[model samples]
Target: MPPVTERTSSLELPCQDGCVNVSIVVPIFNEEGNVGEFVECVFAALTPTSRAFELIVVDDGSRDASGEMLLRLAAERPWLRPVRLVRNYGQSSALQAGFDRVRGRYVVTLDGDMQNDPFDIPAMLDRLDSDAGIDVISGWREHRQDKALSRRLPSYIANALISRVTGVQLNDYGCALKAYRREVIDRIRLYGELHRFIPSLARDVGARIAEMPVRHHARTHGVSKYGIDRTFRVVLDLMLIVFFMRYRQRPLHAFGGLGLWLAALGVAILSWLGLLKLLGEHIAGRPLLTVGVLLLVVGVQLVVAGLVGELLSRIYHEGRGGAQYHVRDTRN
Candidate 1:
């Protein structure tokens, strides 16, 4: 888990009178060159809509002048709200901090690097509003502008693998431009690098998700924050998502099932050795006895772990007052 420190606002802000129609959250880290243009682009895209909206830019402890720029921008633009964390807590944490302060019926998230076009916001909002069933509208960069080998190729493979594992079937999990209904997003708790798996996490809670192709631009400032190492991180996070999806409620089923199979195999092996001993064959010096004993011990330990997991699961829900199921709505 990333250290979540106390957040301070660069400007003393007043709360909005009512819930705005839309809230846009962009996580910023060392993007001094793009911050000004990014704000301008967002305002250009949204100002004509005539719908109430707020722009939240979270500065994740940038070593550059990004924080200073945001402070100046927020002071000038009343709608622009800036959040500054004590230190760099990565993108996921910054987004969560922004999400916590959103006062909108609909939420939009995009990267601050300018690769994600803010012009796509209106179309996504339209799609989400016009359709009654869709709860999430994810942007897909079909014509990605990054290098094919170093950037796009690994992302392509990762998106496919994540889709297959989580059963969400999204074409671009890495794309940050996505629109979500407030109710659906409120149910989610962001931590770790799970922001990329938002669509999948929303699906787990019965959200109706859709994807559309959006514009992707080449980076013109600073440098790329990600590298080849990101692929490995994605793989590790994917495994955690799979575990929570399948066995979060009843982890005993996953561990105990494997334990039982190993214990049965161990029993079979030891029983064969006993039969050989009955036939007057030397069995004490055989390696099969040691293998059988090791299997039995490991199998028992796994079963104990399963029991412990069950206890933790109960405590987690009961302590947090969380229910195993979600209620979409209720009526008389």
Candidate 2:
């Protein structure tokens, strides 16, 4: 609906002076059965650490009682902040909303299904804080508690494929129990299903990421929002990630390079056809002539597409007042 600028501008950043040590973001969609226990578990887990924390539960327009429960819980717990979306905008959008409102030095994200153990958060935070080099600590569900075929099999395949494609190898890209330094998380803008690729996205912006084994519990309530169909979506999103990783800056290099190859092949084919025509064997009726002509047309179109890509690339970078380079630090 509203543009991101408009949506974010209206919200206030609730934490200043790093008053909040950790901001835990949980995106809920029809998770009424798990909401109360999830909140309590988070509080109980974080309370023992003696670290000030805020729990932001994003209700993604649940048809069930999830929204009402969050509202009731927020009233009782000052630290619990509930964000109600107008309608379900998927997990990525919901996470982005919570990220925009976070007011902590460190940010953590977990599922509202209670499958992610809140108790593991402290260790993740410790790993992040202990290492200056590590910007993100991703959870790896070592012995996952899910069906072999429906969940684990697809997840295993997807994780392997994503790691190989993105070149930021991690055992479990599907685990939502991740911790990030606020700065690292702030640089990322989540959309579509990009939440699953946060580690790879963080790497794109020069973030150092690490993975730690975390406990995964079987779903206690509500059906899994994901299924075998999600594997197809992941593959599509992975293609986007690869394009962004490799061609985000010099898109012309990718498009133009391929375009040039296609154009060259087309030209070669046409030249051969032209030579055959000169040899005079009635080349007008030849199928090769039509194929050559089609290739030439398609090739020209691709090169034109490349030029358009270059223009759009420039606009994207310049419009945002962003550069192709990211500065880690400056001593001057």
Question: What value does the lDDT take at residue 213 in candidate 1?
Answer: 95
Worst 10 residues of 2 by lDDT: 1-10
Q: TM-score for candidate 2, please give it.
A: 0.92
- Top candidate by lDDT: 1
Q: How high is the lDDT of residue 54 in model 1? A: 89
Stretches > 4 Å off in candidate 2: 1-17
On residues 1-332, what C-alpha lDDT tens digit does candidate 2 reach at each position?
A: 11112122212324344689999999999999999888778876877677888999999999999999999877757788999999999999999999999998999999989888999999999888789989999999998889657888789889999998889999999999999999888788999989989999999989999899999888879989877888899999999989988888887778778777777888898899888778975678888778777777777777788789988888878887767877788996
Q: lDDT value for candidate 1?
A: 0.87
What local distance difference test score does each model get?
0.87, 0.86
Model 1 ranges off by over 4 Å: 1-17
Each candidate structure's TM-score, on Cα atoms with residue i matched to residue i, is 0.92, 0.92
Question: C-alpha displacement of 213 in model 2, angstroms?
Answer: 0.7
Residue 205, model 2: Cα distance from true site in angstroms: 0.8
Alpha-carbon error at 148 in model 1, in Å?
4.7
- What digit string (tens of lDDT, one per residue) describes model 1 on residues 1-71? 11222323422233374748899999999999999888878877776676678899999999999999999
